[model samples]
Target: MNHPNMKKDQPVTLQTFKKGDKYHHKIVVEEAGYINDVIFRLGRETPGSYNGQQITVNYEEQGGALVGTVKYPAHNKVIHNTYEMDGQNLAKTSECEGVVHKRWYNKQQN
Candidate 1:
């Protein structure tokens, strides 16, 4: 559970939406500040999709990684995500059900 590659101050957000027959996942963070406020606000303001599933969201720290968990009880799905940020490089690992997904992203230099 300890992720030494992550940073404590930066929080990560993970989102999954089911469209058609597949679930699309997205993990993102704000470049300037934490994304907690924006994510919560959008979640509340956004209308539910056709799936009509209810989800519970929580946040915690695992080592230096910022962990986010979202539970979809209606579909018996739970996703746990931990993210690491090193300068402009971002990496995330998401576990849902029994599948694990890892990805790396590099921010474009401006």
Candidate 2:
């Protein structure tokens, strides 16, 4: 998925870190001409574990202006997910269950 304001084929980086007994993963995307970046973090759990998993995502505009964070819970296994500009929710579909979607743009400012 792509944000309207974000350029096509923008640079994205994924990194993993260990804190305490849990593992954390972070995915970051940098927007051209913007000081702020989009960040996504997975809950402290081993990979391939989706049950009860939580994902925290946030996007910030240039110059530290606008920022918003949204959280999604995986009651079931998530199969497909996408994010787009002007969209406030995480478009997700579960494997066992039906579609599960939630927006995380409550802290955004126009």
Candidate 3:
């Protein structure tokens, strides 16, 4: 999620904070209105920029977490992700290449 006022071409840094570093984080979806579901991916680059990257997904409920697989045929690489909501936050564990990446996202309050 990003600030709605931010332009698509705006530069943004996506990094994890160090264990001892203090930081504030939130994923905001402002004026989202009504939707049937919320599905997204987290990466250094937008998912659309990946050539030959095929994505398949399904969800168990409306506006709920998703389970999906992202495959990069060009590199023979694949990432599998399973998502769930923990309390008010979003949590996911991704198996990419040979590494496991765990991510959590806090929902922003209005």
Backbone atom clashes (below 3 Å) for every candidate: 0, 1, 0
Q: What is the lDDT of residue 54 in candidate 2?
A: 55
Error of 2 at 60 (Å): 30
Badly placed stretches (over 4 Å) of model 3 are 1-48, 51-64
lDDT of 3 by residue, 3-96 (tens): 4565655433222222342221222333432112223333222233222244333223225555556556566777777767899766777998
lDDT of 1 by residue, 8-78 (tens): 66556555444664334454555433222213221222222222456666555567666677677678887
Candidate 2, poorest ten consecutive residues by summed lDDT: 43-52
Better of 1 and 3 by TM-score: 1
How close is each model in CA RMSD to the real structure?
13.3, 15.1, 13.0
lDDT of each: 0.56, 0.38, 0.47
- Model 1 scores a C-alpha lDDT of 0.56
- lDDT for 47 in candidate 2 is 30
A best-first ranking of the candidates according to their TM-score comes to 1, 3, 2
Q: What are the clashing pairs of model 2?
A: 89-103
Candidate 3 versus truth, CA RMSD in Å, comes to: 13.0
Ranked by lDDT, the better of candidates 2 and 3 is 3
Error of 3 at 84 (Å): 0.7
